[model samples]
Target: MNPAEQAPSYRGASEHYLSPSRRDPVKVLSEEPVTRRVLTEALAALALPDDRPVDVLDIGSGTADGFSLLTRAADGDPAVVEEARLHYVGLDVDPEMVETAGEQVRSPSASFVHGDVRSGIPGGAFDLYLSCGVPYSHLTRDELVGALRSVLTAVAGRGRRAAVVVDVLGRYSVEWQPNWHLDRWDYAMSFFAGGGSGISEPMTFYDAPALTSVLDEAMAGTGATVVSRTAVDRSVLVGRHTATGTFNPGVPRFRTLVNDLLRDPASVDPADLRFTPATGGAPRDVLDWLAGFAARWNAALQPYTGAGPLDRDAAARLAHALLGLERAGGPGLGVGHSFTTTLVVDPA
Candidate 1:
């Protein structure tokens, strides 16, 4: 099988889903909320047809995770998107993934198909194109551009408004501080037990500028004009790899500490949450941003240090404060673990 066609090894997929890391407070409180916010904004920007259900195409869908995500984004709010009005098609290159998705997502409005976006997008034009899990990061830069160009061209041919959410690995995540100097490198799913298929693949990483360039090139002459682009950085400090320390050993186990704080504030020592970024390699601005964020993060923890186990209320408040700090840090410049860009496209 082509390396590109290889499905992410899910030998322990069930274990992974049931793992604490999957349901950690950071994932539920920060990552999912940010993603859902962007997805909601994208849906709101679209001009839906009253005559038919809104068509959605999920590229690189894995076991219909994107489908679940979209459902949550709608949150049964008819004003945003009604569950009954959604017609979802999930496309992937792995037949096993498609079959698994079909088995998992038994929605009347949802279907899964095997297809690779780099070669072509199956089904047809859609009102929204969605992807998650940084699937596009599996593609080379040129391949991603080609895949996106095909999507834009299809939207243009349809002559309708649409939205595309592109998710990719951020270049400057502290989890891989050592590789900030390189855009592409072997990234392993070390978080999984037994090293997740025990295979490392060369994955692409992107900053806002690089990703914007790819989108611009893909849109050029495709008769698709971007109405707006919103970039969001998810998991700036609490990325999964922070606990594994696989790529950057110097990084603190922020994910584990945060999860501990969420579960039982007394279990974590606030002093251990201090973030001291690895120096050199990354851009100065990125380093500075991390430094600034670290200062705030540490300060937030200072009140709890030596203060003994926090009461339930205090612990909840502190967690909320940290999440707020991440949100107020300004537009994402690829500082997070996952960088997502949602483009509202006008195929006029």
Candidate 2:
């Protein structure tokens, strides 16, 4: 099958959903500080040369919010902030998106282009090839492999070490349990009605092994090699979105319920913990509900982590475990709402 055939074309309806003015929930959720941390960490992994300004190609760079986020991350570091000069090229398939992004993202080093990667990635010799907002998840495995090879080949031609970050949907997410087997699903964000324009787009999901397989195939002949792969954005809170009637009939009013629990765990009485088949209510206990979700995700992750089902106390254990660490995104707590497997590739 043609790779482009498998990808979702976000026109008209979808275009409105990506508008920065609308405060798109998915856009807001994906661009959360925690989520943006993944990109910042990937930037740090580049170990870029100080001798020259870094050239970056951001694929599917919607609204170019990520460019702004990256700049903020660099600015936070006094040591490298002034030392690092960046030239960013934001590429998106949507002409409107490119135009909109061009307006929002302004920098002496940043430029915007309207193009599709299936055809070709514009510019060349970029020190960093970045893809966020699960852009690769729109392509089929074959399409993804082909696209990777194209960019890697271009970077290889330059004969310089570079890093590529591909962010996609996670397979075992509670948001789409009913459609997990199929690689593609219509992701609904009805809550962002203003942004969505009453339309959803088909998106593909991936596991680590599948991602690794494609990356390996893409780099086979090229000088690029995978240095490391890190999983980030293990969101324990996103499954609550399931209650919004956008996903399967599982958790009704999950966000409201989770908010109650977050505010006062004791306020949720024991009676509330019972699942109601008649109403399709989530588990009465918030932790138990989250644990069940975690267990299901763990089962899907078994092939990659070789770990058994996570327990009801998993979140608490993870929280306690995290206190000892000085950082986040070390390894997902196995409860991410959407996981990003950032493969650090070196095109030396």
Candidate 3:
């Protein structure tokens, strides 16, 4: 067995964070208009038997954030969610996360499971598999490819039209984009202040090509064909999985700037790179979409420091600007570390 199979996932960590609390702002984002719009558009034509219910699995459903949001949406507005019961399984490699998922979170239709997604996924004939927040970057390239294949296979059990939706790093995003920023705060979200005790291999970024290759391999493994694949306004890729092929095109930004810099890093100084400032726009658009696009995060992160979830709104202006950069890549705040990208995948 590979190391991923041996690694215990801390699925409970996420549940603890998302537990019953108005303090759970992340859950708030998961429940917002932006997230729902994305999901609604993504799952529109899957056709999972509206007369009754359908089973959906979040292979790496951290903290039940996505589930909580979906559950609330189903309750808050059942018209969009046609299923009688939204059966869901949230799996993670860590035991604590699974434990937390079970204790908190109120949804009769949902259950938490302890399993390593790095190896083979759980045995369930699920109609939909939802993975959010580009979690695949937590694994190595080989492991990522393997994991994608595993997800498809798990959802494929004895069925012809199983679909898997995932958010991951764009391979084209790796080079010269000032990859790999140190993230202690978010790491603390796991509650392991120093990150887990296990010997961790530091994570890296991917370029566009590598991201595409993983999709190719995943499609081949599931024996599913790609029904749809498109970069949703630069930050997300939405694709439908079928019995033929799948195409995944992750977000791209710094890459466009990197090319410009490579041609002339000296001339690329100052205004060539602009650390986006927080500015507001339509509430329906993702608040952080633009902030995540900045070529450099240091300066852009200033207003966000010492702030909690509620404070993120203060940074909305910055996020709105970054959203513009998403459409037109640029630069800024350059000590070390930069760039954020997202990808989505569905089974054929």
Leading candidate by TM-score: 1
Q: Over the stretch 280-299, how does candidate 3's per-residue lDDT look in tens digits? A: 42121222443554434435
Q: Write one digit per residue (lDDT tens) for candidate 1, span 1-348.
A: 654455455444444543554666777777776777777788878856565688899998877777777775432443345567888999987776778789878889899888888878875769989998898998999999999999999988897899999999999998888788899999987776422344478899999889989999999989888999888888888888998899989888888877777678777777788777656677677778777888888889888778877877777777877877765533668888899999999885
> Which model is ahead, 1 or 2, in terms of lDDT?
1
RMSD of each: 2.7, 8.8, 12.6
Ranking by TM-score: 1, 2, 3
Model 3 Cα shift for residue 6 (angstroms): 4.4
Report the lDDT tens digits of candidate 2 across residue range 1-348. 543354454555445545554442323332345555666667678776566787889888877755766665432443222214878899887776777788766667789997778888886788778876677877778878888898888877776767677777766555555655666777765654334555467766665566678778988897777778777544443343554646655644433333333334333332222232211222233335445544543443333232333333542233223221212322432223455666666665
Model 3: lDDT to the true structure: 0.46
Q: Model 2, stretches more than 4 Å misplaced?
A: 1-31, 73-84, 193-196, 252-335
RMSD of 3: 12.6
TM-score of each model, paired residue for residue: 0.90, 0.70, 0.57
CA lDDT scores, all candidates in order: 0.80, 0.58, 0.46
Name the candidate, 2 or 3, with the larger lDDT value. 2
